[model samples]
Target: MERLFGRAWLVLGHESQVLAPGDFLTTRMGREPVIVVRHVDGSIQVLVNRCAHRGSRVCEGPRGHARQLVCPYHGWTYATDGTLCALPLAEGYDRSPIGVEELGLRRVPRVETYRGFIFASLAPDGPSLLEFLGPLRASFDDLVERAPAGEVEVAGGVFKHAYRGNWKLVLENHNDGVHPAFVHASSIWAARNGAPWDVWEKTGLWVARYGHSWMGDYHDDTRLVAALDHPVFREYRAALERRLGPERTARVLGELRWNSLVYPSCSFMSQFRQLRIIHPIAVDRTVVHAYSFRLKGAPQQMFRDTIAFANVVNGTASPVLTDDLEVYERVQDALTASRNEWVELGRGHGGDVPDRDGTLRGRTGTSEIHIRNQLAAWLEYLDMGGPEGRADAPAMAPQSAQRSEAPRQSRNAPRPA
Candidate 1:
């Protein structure tokens, strides 16, 4: 894998993470360490956390409010905008070119906000946030608007997990609705007491354009739909109706069950009200952050149900996800061996019918079409000159994996539309 910024989506943090002035957050995209801060003037900024004086990290904590990014080594202070606003000594050297302006922290090439979510791009060129989001914008709007209060906040903290496999596997898993019936057969069966879950039969699986796709929509399936029709969903719909009116409530809630993948590295399973982050630490080892979201103005039980679902399905302790983790780990270990250069993606080969917007649909949930969609985005990033290219035109490429093996490509790889 290559680290090309243009070919892939690199910026990952959202604006809501830093709400108050002086609020700061530390995170990494691809390989760059980022510092997101709400400056004194109440504006948000993203800059490289490395200090100009010496190549040392400026921010030490995950998140906090700070007076300034004080480099503890020499007490060098920088403003939230990455400007070198203060110095400890007046005259350390007679003739120094280290002017405050020259020594300001290096800011990322691009930064922007959508709704309240903040994002930064280390690369200078590619799709703007709106262009990049594509169909995802509507899904995100629904995620926030469906709430009675029309706002969402991070809650229940974040759960960090690791898998000994490529981060792409997680993306493939997220857009893969078919796997639940088989990969999660144990849990699904147990949930249904050995009876075949009807939702499994009539799953409303969809693979949308631009690498966005979803699984797990059987809300109308008489048997499996019963699960969501319970008091929790009913109350949620009622509250939403009061806030947005009957039409809007029906539009958001009764529309669909969307467990979606945001191209490159984000997952929002709307039903669960959980958002997961996939941070590629290394080719083989990836970090997963599962954050719970509270629907603003929704009932306490609604929020509690969101948390419970996170714990029951997406949490590290989840019976369903534990098996997934194990499978991912196993896949990583096995791919290291020498047998073939390509992994199997022929599950629904030649059968994917093109959707209205050029997205390909699979015959069933287990089809590898979702993985194919993700790899299309991955390859596009690689083709764009990836992270190693010049500053003017960034390219997208996969960050290299630790072990050496020819990067696999599918035999029936669809021509990306």
Candidate 2:
């Protein structure tokens, strides 16, 4: 955790969760608990939830509006900005070198927001959030620009689930492209006769620097934006056209990206308006929080469709999600065996073509290039020297299995949002 999430920029929550002064939501940076609050000064603060006095957690609830944070264990009161304001029996530590002024909650070193999504980093210094986001910022733009009012907010609450599997499994599965055919066979059968396997051929799989990757939409009528004949969808499009004009509206809706991974912590779908944050608790356990967004100024049915998509695809009761979860646990269980020492990620190897935009595109949509790119970034973050010097080198396939030339291309290529 210290090497991966501890030093990386992680998503805390959305700005809407703490919009008003004193509104706060509790989340975590890896395993360390944190409170994201809106201060009276109108600034957002990400503070450690541990009390300054005895290291007890000051905030217990998931979310609330509070004037100040008070530890139930010792009744130590702290201001919204994390300044220690009051404590019972002040004479207890009269001679101690530590003063009340120094007991405020420790603020995270850096906090930044892209659009309405907030991110915090525990590390004191590194690449700025924009530098880290690189080309993936367009994914966020694709989401927010869909709203006629030019904003999107978290809505319909959040769906949280825990699984007995490594956190990396979920991120890898999001863009695997090959798993849904077998894993979601039941859901496909129930929805219709079978899956549209041909959609894979039309979609594009893109991998960028920092392990971020996204796939183009299926472009079939089953997509969220494909209901052109529905009056609600027409209204929604007209609203967007009024705000963005015909040309910009065409460009915005023309974006076909589906699932986008902001490496290490976040995965989102622009079309369905769903955002999920991955929280790693232990090596074999993880929790995910799924949130649905409501586009401002869009038709009410649009938000309803967003909720329906969440319930059908992301909710705990979802057949589609449960199938993936079961597979995750099964994979975890089998991985403990001593039989296999390496996980092969060589599907579509040597077939990732270079794009003019500097990203590596899988030769086919069903390739495992996304996983290889993610593991390469994983090694970079852990500072484990490439496959040559690492002790656990056998755990991975090989360095040549990944697209090594793409980074050189990315370094000099112009980043397109």
Candidate 3:
């Protein structure tokens, strides 16, 4: 765990989560709890969730608009900006300064926002979010740029679920396209019970640089492609054709389905209109948060289609996801056996092509290239030393109750990117 935390990229929330003044949310970095808040002055701040007074936590709620964060332990109150505000029954000591600044919440060392998402680094130095995003940034821009409104937000409440497997398994599965045909046989059968085989085979899947991948031509269900295709999907293709010309649009649209593993934690299924975040809980447990977004300015049917897609592919009860989860859990269980020294990542090992960027890519769905890339990043982050070094192991477990406000200092700090 120390090795894992040492070089871990402790990125938490994006800037859009705290859009309004007093809007705040709590997230964890490793085992440390962090509170991100939009201050009264309209600035965003990230702080530790621990209270300065009596070492008790400040806020206990998950999220809410609050002018002040009042600690329930000793009645210590703090302004939204993390300034220590009021303590009950003041005026006991005249010789000392007990003002807000003195007791202000502990602030994260470095905070940066990229593309409206906020990130903090516990370490004073590391790659910026843009640098960290690397090849994944282009994929994110492509998704948002396709939107006529050129913006996206977390639309509905997030769906939080737990996986009884190593977090890495879930991360690897995000871009693993090979499992769909075999593991998702039920879904594929249901999707094509009355449809044609050629159309199903025509649906293209693509793997991108640095573990980012997607499937394309999803609408080629023979039924839909036999028609003119949905107007919105048609418009999306047409606009791309106009911008990049017919040949390029054919190349781009014919390739790629999901845009996932945006480095470190986040994975986006652009076509499904949902993003899934992988949060590590322990050696054998992971908490996944799935967020669906309403594409701003998109047709209502588009959002509905996205929800339906989510239900079919990403829902907890979906045949595809259920089988995948079973495999992951079994893998975790098997790895604990005495025989296996390391999980094999040897598939499609040397076949990766070096792109213009420094990242590597493998062509086939059978490749474990994405898993290799993720482990590479994970190893790099864990070597840098982190919260696990503290005398007291950070509370990596989930708190039974939600916490609202926390001290800016003494909380877990962000790790390098």
Candidate 4:
């Protein structure tokens, strides 16, 4: 945790969660509780939630508006910016060398936002958030641009669930295009009468630096957001065209990307306007918070579609998600009992080609290249002797050039039957 999450930028929440001064949301940055609050100065502050007087966490609720943070233990109070403001029995510390000014809740070393998504880092120095995001910034652009008013905000509350599995499993599963056919077979069989699937054929996989990856649109307009001819969709498109013009609107709507991973933290679907943040509690336990976004100027039906998709895919009662949760737990159990240290991820190995944008494109969407890319990043961040260890080191090199070295087992292994 210290090496991977402590040193890396992790998404906290969206800027919309704390729009006004004193608006605040409590979340975890890899198990450490923290508060993302808007200050009186009109700036966002990421403060450690632990009270200064003692170690008790200050914020218990998920989110709210607060003029100041008061510790429940001893009534020690702090301002929205994390300044230590008041505390009980102040005269007791009169003779102490340390003053109350030195006891403010520790602020996260760095905080940044890109396109209303907030991120904070515990490390004092490293690559800026922009450099860490690399080309994945375009994924956020794709999301916000779909908003007719050129902005998006969190809506419809959150869908939260806990699974008895490692957090990495879900992150890996999201971009593993091969799993939905089998993992979601029950749901598919009930919905589609067991039709043969060919989602990967239309999808493209792209991997970027710093472990970021995303899948191109697998579902066409007809399946993705109702038919392009649907009246609500037509209205949504008209609204976008007014702001972005007809040509730009056509280009935006034409782009079809699905799940995108921002590495070590969050995965989101621009098509459905859903964002899921992963929180690791222990090696065998994980929690996820799923949120839906509303396009600023889009029709109400559009947001309704977002909610319906969330219920079907991300909600706790979702058969699709429950299927995945069961599989994740089973995999975790198997992994705990297995003797082998290595799990193969060789699908489409050595077949990824470089794209014009400096990213690697998988030969097929079914490739496990996304998982491999994530593991490579995991190794990089965990390596105390690697670039992440040094304060001045540059970000990891693009994984495209590293694909030449295939795993030894993959070279000699027989193709799967």
Candidate 5:
């Protein structure tokens, strides 16, 4: 775990989450407790959430705004920049070899933000965020460009939940469309009952550079969107048309390419306007944190839809996602069986075509290309080192066992509104 995570660039939080001075959000960068805070001057800082004096957490909540972080154990204080600013007794420290400056909250070493997304690295040196993200950058582009003003703000609030499973299990599941028909049979019975067939026919998978992969639509299915007939959605569509023109607006909002997972920690599906974080709590447990976004300059109802879509798809009690969580726990339990050795990554094997960027996309959506791609990345990180050591691998594209099959049509008819 340390080798896989401790040396990589991980997301701390979004810039919008802590927009105001002193606004802070607590999160886990791997197993380490981290605080993403904004200072009065507007600079962002990521501080380790431990007190220099007694090793207690200076900031003890999930989120809060504070002038400074004061240790609950002692009076030692730190500025929003993580600079040690105060101590209860100066004379006591004068006798010690360390100065107050030496005792400031430890910074995460390398902190950077790209397009309002904040990330930190524990290792001192590695690829820049640009190199690390590579083609996955398009996901952010598709997300932000959906806004008429070309921007998005984290709105509504965050939804946090967890499942009893390995962290990789969630990442694999994010793009594993073959399971919805079985695992999620009850929840999506009306639409996705025969998931391998239904989802396979509708969703095509794309693998991008740096192990980032996503599922795009094989055919236009606007029923889910058109059914969202509300004053807010109408206004939002009109606003998008004014900025993006009619054809483009339809392509952007009407056809959603959902479940874009940026390897290691986060996934954002712009069509749904939702972002989810996969935090590894242990070898067998994972916490998922989700947030909804409001495209700046879009209709207010659009933000409401973002929340509604997330609730149905990934809410704490989501009718859809809860089914997956239960299966993940059960799968984690089932793996303990003596006969279990390896899980299948052979779905739709060999259906991938080169994406021309050292990555490949599946000819069929049901292909295990996405899962195998991520596991390849995981092995690379755990063995070869993170992004820094990935360049030496065989184009970093692990080809599935050679085979080919045409997609089957979905058996279930579209559900009525």
Candidate 6:
């Protein structure tokens, strides 16, 4: 876990989260607490959340705007840039050799941003942010390009859901096309008022270069939404095309799908009209943050429509998510008692082909390629330290659950060119 944290770029917060100086938000990089702050100069900084003095955490609330951070335990204070500003009693340390430089909040080694998404890496020498993102870069482009200026901000607040299951379960479920029909049947039934499943035969799964994947329909199915009385999707597509041009618009809204899992940290799903961040609290527990936003040049009604859909499908206590949580917990529980070593990744597993662009395309809607991709990515990250260290141990298995399974698929998820 430590090696994984050290080796990978971790998303701390969006640039919009800290628009003003002294603006800061607290989050975790692996298990360590981290703070993302905007300095007085408008530059962003990410620092380890702990106070250098006595190792107590400096930032307390989830987010705040303060001239300086003051540790509650003692009077130690630091500037927004994390420079040690003051210690309540200077005489206590007069004879000692300790200096202000060493006491400043520790900065995360490698911090970088793409569009407005800020990410940090604890290890200094690994891949740059762009290098790490690889083919998954297009998804980020697709996201921010939805706005007129080709940018986006974190808006509409965060929708957080907590569940008792291994974080891997959520990863597996993100692009698991098969489970949606079965797991979300009641929710879909209610949404469509008990109509039979609208599973589209035209749908497919995509696996991108770095394990980013999703399952979505080939195009908007007007019949699926006709009963909902929401005819806005057509006009929305028209609006996007008019504003972004046919090619750019196609890149942004043309695909018309959901669950673009951006590797280990985030998933952007337009089907629910939100970007989700998956935070692993422990092996057996996870928290999901769902942020819904509006496009800058788009109509106000568009934002409202998106949020309305999100409220129905991904909102807290959502029928769809509620069902998903129940099943995740059930799986976790069953795994605790099962004698089986490897769970199945066999459902519609092998009908994948590679595209000319090097993406893996799964022929079946219910293919397990996405789960298989994520599991492999997870293991590859865990093996960063090589065979001599923690990699040799079966730490990927949660103490409360049984062993996990991962396989390989060569095709990749597509991002707009």
Best by TM-score: 4
Clash list (residue pairs), candidate 4 = none
CA lDDT of each candidate?
0.69, 0.83, 0.62, 0.83, 0.75, 0.71
What clash count goes with each model?
A: 21, 0, 26, 0, 0, 8
| lDDT sort, best first | 4, 2, 5, 6, 1, 3
TM-score of each: 0.85, 0.90, 0.78, 0.91, 0.87, 0.85
lDDT score for residue 96 of model 2: 42
Candidate that beats the other on lDDT, 4 or 5, i.e. the better one: 4
Instruction: Indicate the worst ten consecutive residues by lDDT in candidate 5.
Output: 407-416
- After superposing candidate 5 on the true structure, give the runs of residues whose Cα lies further than 4 Å from its correct spot: 95-101, 190-199, 218-234, 245-251, 390-417
lDDT of 6 at 258: 59
What C-alpha root-mean-square deviation, in Å, does candidate 6 show against the real structure? 5.2
| Model 5, residue pairs in steric clash | none
RMSD each, Å: 5.0, 4.6, 9.3, 5.2, 7.3, 5.2
Model 1 misplaced regions, further than 4 Å = 1-7, 94-99, 193-201, 208-210, 219-235, 356-358, 386-417
Q: What is the lDDT of residue 7 in candidate 6?
A: 58
Per-residue CA lDDT of model 4 for 1-417, tens digit only, reads: 888888778988899999999999999998689999999999999999998777999988999998989999999888888888787777787554233556988899999999999999888887899988877888888899999999999999999999999999998999887787898898888898343447674478888766778998666553454544688888888899999999998888777788999889899998789999999999999999999999999999989989999999999899999999999999999997667976888888888877846688877888888888877677667654222456554443446325424532222212111
> Model 2 over residues 1-417: C-alpha lDDT tens digits?
876787778888889999999999999999789999999999999999999888999999889999989999989888888998788887777554234556889899899999989999888776788877878888999999999999999999899988999999998999977788899998887887454667775578888777788988654323444554778878888999999998998889888788999889999999789999999998999999999999999999989989999999889899999999999999988999997877887787778788845678888888888888887777666653321223553433346435444432332333221
How many steric clashes does model 5 contain?
A: 0
Q: How accurate is candidate 5 locally (lDDT)?
A: 0.75
lDDT of 3: 0.62
Cα lDDT of model 4 overall? Answer: 0.83
Residue 55 of model 1 has an lDDT of: 74
